[model samples]
Target chain A: MRVSLKTVLTLTTLFFISACGADDAADSMWRKLPLNNTVLLTLPHGKVVIELAPQFSPKNTAQFSKLTQQGFYDGTKFYRVIDGFVAQAGPKDGSKKDLSVPILAMEADFKVAKDWAYTPVQQQGLFAQQTGFKDGFAIAYQQGKSPNSGKAWLTHCPGTIAMARNNAADSASSHFYIVIGQAPRYLDRIMTIYGRVVHGMQHVQAIQRTAVIEGEYAVDHRDFTEIVSMQLMSDVAKAEQIHIEVENTESKAFAERLVKRRNRDSAFFYNKPPPVLDVCQIPIRSRIVK
Target chain B: MRVSLKTVLTLTTLFFISACGADDAADSMWRKLPLNNTVLLTLPHGKVVIELAPQFSPKNTAQFSKLTQQGFYDGTKFYRVIDGFVAQAGPKDGSKKDLSVPILAMEADFKVAKDWAYTPVQQQGLFAQQTGFKDGFAIAYQQGKSPNSGKAWLTHCPGTIAMARNNAADSASSHFYIVIGQAPRYLDRIMTIYGRVVHGMQHVQAIQRTAVIEGEYAVDHRDFTEIVSMQLMSDVAKAEQIHIEVENTESKAFAERLVKRRNRDSAFFYNKPPPVLDVCQIPIRSRIVK
Candidate 1:
């Protein structure tokens, strides 16, 4: 689906119109993400909305959903924050043993069949055979032995939410982290990525980073950013809830956006280089609906 | 030159042995960057040392040097900080009109000739024909109409120091920014890259980010992170100076490091992915000398 710039602009205009009290118009263009699959994390500065990727990591997402429903993440502190890496948070004492929830078997949903319609950005990525987007998430696919047999996994781009585990693969319970800087592609297939930050990334970036001593983050409990409360969007009252609509990766507008980003011809550029695109560099637009 | 891992490890061991107080051995492998070309930017958290890239952008580097010598950056505030993007700073009030230094002619040192020996990482990049490291900076080179005729420019990777310009290509003056998140490769060839943060990037990342309103950062001067002082390292007393040594891009050790980063068989990685590397992911190791 090839969308022209004018058409995309029109679509964007329509999107805004829908956002500004025009529910019917907005509903036609933007698909509302399931409220049950969304999580609202409140910080002192603002609120961060996360959309779970259940199709990719069902087990991990289910466990996280169960934990959030039980108020397990409320009052948890972001204990470890390494600059240009990740911001890890959970219980203050780092004791997950006391949590009532059973440890989830590790779901390293590293790859999926390439059967789903995906927009390929590159034939090869920094650490993957192919890179593209799947349901608004940046992803990489392995080169299959056959044409349609490849597997795809979520790329560790900034704002990715993943389950934190111990040396054992099945150790992931309540601890989780958000990628806060350059995409740490090294962790792509090693950890289970269940969701991504859909809004309020600035709040996550505002969290005070900890000092590093001998390559380890030296965090103080008192200085940690407190999680005011975490609740599934569905669990919140309708009046107080915030709804999100992610730009469909399969849509024509997204294709246009991809092209515009790949080849920038702004007045600021003295020398326009050839168009090369990274999957993470392509932003998936997310809008809030009150 | 392709260097074997054993040889690199041996050199590293020797380098560590030399670092154990043997000033002579340390000086041999590491070239001492001219202190005159180095800037010490003091932040509330710590001092960030930036090494000028005079070879790539001579005019801009000279202007920056003069500005530092004249104490133009003293008491300046990092007024604009966007998470996973950039930390911009200069004279407050967003005015360079009062600065004593002459406004430099825009030297958009986006690309250089591929004459110097460069360790090429990829035949192609997201926006460039080729990607590699030149003099310890992540760079992309234009695909020349003919071999050896294309130009190269510094990439907008984390810690890269670039001149912030207005809409006009040549309007850069007293404003600059350091990339703090994922590499915004789209900015390549558009801005003037004069230097890079060699040490204390953690301090750079620690700068408090401002709130966002309608996609623009809402900065409050009262909450700004102050630039306590900015001075050339040479201007300081020899006894108080902090020296740095960047890993030679043309050296054998760097090549080995690149390979290791691309493919990891570490205990933590349950399933190691293919060895694909991004030039920005290959860190140019820089350290302080006693």
Candidate 2:
């Protein structure tokens, strides 16, 4: 179900050209993200901008916002970095006991209704009945369920941000992880995914992976990637504030882009395989609103 | 499609215990990999052992072997490393013109026969009609084709090694790249996959990523990760040669492992979603032959 190349070109031209002036279509497709719901995570390499998905996990988002305002993560270190898995960061100390905030209830945030206007890439998924995108987040839903009763959850694709938990479901307090490699979809519907890295994923990948000794990632706290600071975009000074805009997932341009990706007929490809698409492969373009 | 866990455990116990005395099944499933088809790649951090898949891509494997024996990649720097995509190395000057070996023909080795004795993981894939494993290599094939008629190619899973080429398919020569993050399945049937990292993948992940500027990785050839030496295992002395063995994909133990991954009912998982297995997620356990 790929869109034609001609349609993609036409849409791209019309969208950018109209965006230069004033067009409702363009405006609707490329709206500025709310500053209050965004976080600027500063690393040694660069700043990683994340747009919180409060709509998916409201409780966890609120908890994160509160912590950001209190400068809780100012000097925290990315303690556990497993190569091809995740880069985790939280308090300098391993224990979550000293945290001021109470433990937030575990929010599996797995599903929304089937009629939620998601652009489904496949009717079947490795972990769910169907896989798609919702508000720029990779998601999956159960099959054979009624349209009004179906459930969906975020897939753990690269750049996905989720709260790290212990054995218990409600153990998540302050620790969080950003997926840096292949999508660990097995974690879907099992963890609370509240945000995603909209920009500066290269910095995330730049973080040094903990050394492996006998097949286990050695935990050396002293060599961890230090977090300079984590602050809400709204809390930053007016001149220093960073603005971002993500391409609307429901927009025509997005649909066109999906089609182009599914059936890439570019000169780069010698043999064009089928137009099949993975939910994780779908691009959610995010740019600084300079 | 999944082998039962009870069966796997039983087979493991019986195989190991009986094999200590005498067992044909154990001998067949745990055969040692040929040292001639294995490469020992030395990095600053550690040694990465890759087993060449000559059966899948004979020409590329042969070319790679010849290059290794000649020490062409001994001092080459990992010139173009894109985080979460590929770590490309070979030819410090970024040109293949000076290589002694003639460029091999582009091997799209995408498909084998339906009766190739591959263990199927999924009937459908993001890039191919069916996906499975052949000799521990992730592979894909077209559907409904006769046993000897269908095509199958190696998938670009993490740790996959393929030739780096220019716009032309046959341009690949001395340069090669290794997939480091999510499986870039799109590269399947487009690049010539010759080998896979059977052990010391941590060393590959440990390589520092060159800083990216304006969404492009900064190419500072002088600061690249250097290859100490690249040699075929057979070329090394008997005492220094690293003996390796990979889990047999066709064995009953592999089936059980697949089932365990597909339906993880472990105590750690709070909410066990329906088990769906991605072909890339399946483990082809490789260990030093003690």
Candidate 3:
């Protein structure tokens, strides 16, 4: 069941060029723009393409680089899989035995605007600015108080990569999880979030619950299943290039799309819901846009 | 191993009593004054304590009662368990070749006021009403539009009991699901939602994924886990004696608590977030405050 990075790239490339057409093909050239900052998150089902937001947390991004280089996460398993909340993974090195090393903390991501509904831009498949990379970090911004003093932070949107922490102020380290549900900003400033999964999140979503040890409740045992190994997409073959086009965060099509979905203008819905969109509710679709 | 309903009710009583205390106990008593309309929800882990929201959806509630009387969902198993999205169940009979009846549609729950939030009315363990049940239907009153005119749909907070349907509206008949994570409003108007899980939701959450088919993802003919059976809490012992108290929807404590949590004055949070609480984001805590 293990999928190789090379195979994925090839399938992705074929999917994009053949399905997305030529104009998109020309725009897809942006992929060639040096992905040195890219990090390949290998999950059991597929790989997560992460564009590190270094600008948001310079130190954290550097740490991530060092950790990836050192292969710290190479063998970690995805330990927690909450249907829609998150899929937690990393050293599953039992916290009880590993509390000695203090967890690290990072600052919040940059903000874009407060109460900003959404403004579409030139991109085709991108969402909010939080949809893209900031150096190595992926984030979203919202105006809080003054129009100019809007703040930015890591959104708990699906596929978000975040550092795990204990119940302390500045506690979070390599242990991470991807948001699989509604954004849990309740954990916002309390935890240090670092990156986001740009592609292949479905693979993580479809992983079967393995090595489950029944406790008082069915909490995943750290020792149950281990992440066999991991590799980066950049190092994979050309045929395996995954042509992903995010919903342009700043595109007019995007905003209208949100409004459309919220109201469900499609024939599918008989009732119209009050128009509102939670940050996490926004979907960032990835198709083969080679 | 599947736990018994009696043990579950006993354990939950302990859980609630331990999780709450004193002056709060008395006030909760006030809020729980008259127990006219009640509903029972059974799960694998144990029996959940729930009261129907007769006010939100009278038609839906009536349909649910009619279906229950016919034992439509008695032997059904929970088919889907998305950690933070929902734990779905209902008529396992639908896909069975022996059965042909379709799912039924239910009306939406009422909306809550924007100004009101669920908080401790008398004690920390008890949360005030973010939404309340009227005539056995889940309803809320938020700030904005008319107190009654504002969109009032089922609050998809955790433990919400809803009916499942096909692509067409009004298709729901026997299938149902429970909210296990943050509310998924995307499914709001699209589906026939009925009631909220009054109790035993944890049991629903704890069910082990078994040999049932994963629909589109089933590898071969391999089966996924299926629910052995489902019973109403009223059918179990101790479930009758279960004293449940909901937070008063019209309480000032609910408003303040929402603001406090939204802002996070506690040291645990280093950054305070915007004070906007979505209708679904409000937490409504229930306890056996006898």
State the lDDT at B113 in candidate 3. Answer: 52
- As a TM-score, model 2 comes out at 0.80
The TM-score that candidate 3 achieves is 0.60
CAPRI verdict on model 1? acceptable
Q: TM-score each candidate.
A: 0.78, 0.80, 0.60
Worst 10 residues of 2 chain A by lDDT: A18-27
> Please, what is the whole-model Cα lDDT of each candidate in the order they appear?
0.73, 0.75, 0.49
Across B61-144, the per-residue lDDT of candidate 2 in tens digits comes to 998999899888898888777666788987744354445547768888645444455666665444666676667788887754
A-chain TM-score of every model: 0.84, 0.85, 0.66
For model 3, residues B50-93, the per-residue Cα lDDT tens digits are: 56655656666666666665566665656665444566665454
Best TM-score among the predictions, by candidate number? 2
Give the lowest summed-lDDT range of ten residues in model 3 chain B.
B120-129
Model 1: per-residue Cα lDDT over A194-247, one tens digit each: 999988887787676764433234567688898998999999889878888878
Q: How does candidate 1 score on lDDT?
A: 0.73
What value of lDDT does candidate 2 attain over all alpha carbons?
A: 0.75
